[model samples]
Target: MGQVPDLPIRNFEVAGQGPAPPVILVRSMHNLLNDAAQRALRYLDELDARSVAPSAEAVAGLSRFQEPLPETSMEPRDVLALLDQIGSPATVATAGSRFFGFVTGGVLPATLAANWLAAAWDQNASMVVLSPVGAALEDVVLAWLRQLFHLPAGSGGALVTGGTMANFTGIAAARHALLNGVGWDVEAQGLFGAPPITVIVGEEVHVSMLKALGLAGLGRERVVRVPADSQGRMRADKLPKLAGPTLICTQAGNVNSGAFDPVGEICARAHEAGAWVHVDGAFGLWAAAARERKHLVEGVELADSWATDCHKWLNVPHDSGIALVRDEQHLVGAIRSTAAYLVHGEQREPHHHTPEASRRARGIEVWAALRSLGRSGLEDMIERTCRHASRFAQGLRAAGYEILNNVVLNQVLVSFGDDETTRRVIAAIQQDGTCWCGGTVWHGRAVMRISVSSWATRDEDVDRSLAAMIRCARSLGVVKNNS
Candidate 1:
């Protein structure tokens, strides 16, 4: 009786005129919305309840659906209902503190909520004219990131999809700068007639660099793999003498181990040789802001360009990467494109700087994340994560497991007994669900990689994960009781 007569909810349609059209629209929306929200909420609650390890079975199960979606059988609502029906009972908690596989970061409440807001707004971040909020936010956040990392004052930044795309943008800019020096326009003129551009990369560099090169018209074989030290850092002394267009790609964070390259030395050499220096700091660049780990990334600011993922170390959501370029013109020149329908604004337009023309308001979540953490919060997170990694490695070593990596930052590589024992232990740990770690081949031997990147991770989480790993190792037949 208290409801208004002109209420908009009363006019909503729930069905089609003929055959109910399978009740696809309303049923799909209702089922999916309800199920998805339920699953998300439950995952969060379960993480809160279980401090150590969360099962990734639900996620892994979804991975099985790689084929095309089935049509006509089930509506979106029905699927949502099914998801709720199935996922409601799932107790997997990897999104919590104990999941260490990959560079997984636990979603901060602020970041998560802001991400939801970003989805709701759905503002395109490409052009300033289209979404002033997004463009302005990116401009503000870029400056903040520069200050946060203590980079050069005048450096420019772009928000990309992730580490891979960030690497692509940074390298592309490097390519453009190198070619431009010799009176060549890469974006305007294709790589067809251009002179050979030598791309030098560390042997331990991530695969994204190779993929980026391929995407930028340079084949993977064209890249020269520079040797790395035992710790997987670029060998600065062995840098080849270059005469022509050259781009030297360096790694700030080695994927297997958390070792850092001598970036200052590499930058100096690359600069002297007139080569564009690009740092692929996928998960390690943020270490510059951590007081304890800052020394490891001492020469990061000196680089011509750097790529890092906010999603990895910063503990933000997926697909958030930041690329910093010292030369603003090169960054802008490489990615900026003009369209007849798009009007140019005199102000700082986000689209003019990045590769994408129409993009989501990615800066909103990033801004929210930065604002929530501030400098001290971020430094605390970095310090805590590193400490946890050390704790994990120490516990395993105490249990007679072989510690592979130097454990410099937040990544720890360990082996159980032998390669087979180690493989079995890794499998048991993954199946045990106390924590999740991936296996990697280090110097011909398989090793477990424990990456600590989540904000939700605490000391207790580390202890629990370590216990699980040790138990799994002991369960392996090769692990001797005396040893």
Candidate 2:
């Protein structure tokens, strides 16, 4: 009773008068996007005018996630202020012409705009009825992607979270088919006390594959590790004679040097042994679409299932990956679920092809990205990235750095002087912020891993990065000491 006497109530007559209608929300979003686009264009103009790299603190801060918010709405101006408070790192610049960091992509206008629309619509792409336009876009995008990779007709495609999930879906399908061949209903019974299935993979396989194995109930350490060449390509001739239900995991592109395994031979050996072949092509699979690099993935079409990322080579924004299976039944059998209450009817459902129930409209961005670039434009992007990688390797080699691995696709691995020098150069390069590259232990030596993949990158950017690398190497006393 102590201070509750002044509580006032609104009249029922004023209850129906709302501040704004739902249509205003839509209009507000449209206006916000238009304003953002105009601002971004102006910022881009300014960024392109500058030659020096921005401060590391400034660039790296962009990745910081904002604080958790209360379950409430704020004023639009307040939200904009929050966005301005956050700073992003140079990774977005890695998508720009000047950055040569990990494989990253600039936001293509069409993809960016489509993603905005997708969020606005907030469509769940689990089934056609959930969002007919999203479902249809996925269908068209999958068809075009299949054709681009030269995959055979009738192959099933799924838009997943990213390459890891893509690999998971592809391997799941492979597991289903391989285990089913031996009379094991994995999906029904789970991996508890099931017949052990053999999984053979190249030593150079990406870490995501191992993660996928764990997720699929196939033990990572249990898989047979095949030997790889100096360039990290799997030795197809060394395929161990195998019996029983088995799965052969091959690489379409080595994550280190972008080298591809002997897909034809590997597929033939797996087929001969009655094993399922799954290719983890996260970025390399798209090389087949580029005429110049198509030979790198010569035998990719023979793969039983494959995984690739739109955010990587395809240059779509984050969180877009595709999994393709040669057999539709295998994909459906692997991921489909049943529930009496939520009957999906006798129609093709998106959930059956993916390991998701209520998923986002990821295909909209992919469709927009592909349609914006078209086939030729995409091939050009791949070819140009490869060329830039070669340029980087050549430039580094000329500057006295030990170029490791063959400049096969778009990955270039190099070392300066000995292990210590290489480590120092990598640290200096990162701290210097002229460009950003990653480090990896390759062939017992720590080396710099440079991946060229942005659509915005050009010859000048490659040259500038190479020059910066040379300067760092020289300053570390490595070039003269080695000479």
Question: Which candidate should be chosen as best, given TM-score against the real structure?
Answer: 2
Clashing pairs in 1: 27-77, 28-76, 28-77, 54-93, 54-94, 55-92, 55-93
Per-residue accuracy of model 2 over 305-414 as CA lDDT, tens digit each: 99999988887778889999999899999998878765475656898898988999989989998898899989999999899999998888877777888897889999
> For model 1, how does the per-residue alpha-carbon lDDT over 1-483 read when each residue is reduced to its tens digit?
122222111234447743434434444445455556667787677665553443466556554446577654654545555665555445445457877887878777788888977886889988888898998899889999999777887787899988988898898888889899999999999898998898888888788889988998887888888888888998998888876888988988888898888889988887888888899999898898898899999987889998989888887777799988998889888988877988788877787777888888888888998899998999999999999999988887877778888999999999776788788888888887777899998878899999999888888888877777777776766464444
The alpha-carbon deviation from the true structure for residue 60 of candidate 2, after best TM-score superposition, in angstroms, is 9.1
lDDT of every predicted structure (CA atoms): 0.81, 0.82
Candidate 1: residue 117 lDDT (0-100): 73
lDDT of 2 at 159: 92
Q: Which ranges in model 2 have alpha carbons more than 4 Å from their true place?
A: 1-13, 16-31, 42-73, 89-92, 341-347, 480-483
lDDT measured at residue 33 in model 2 versus the true structure, 0 to 100: 57
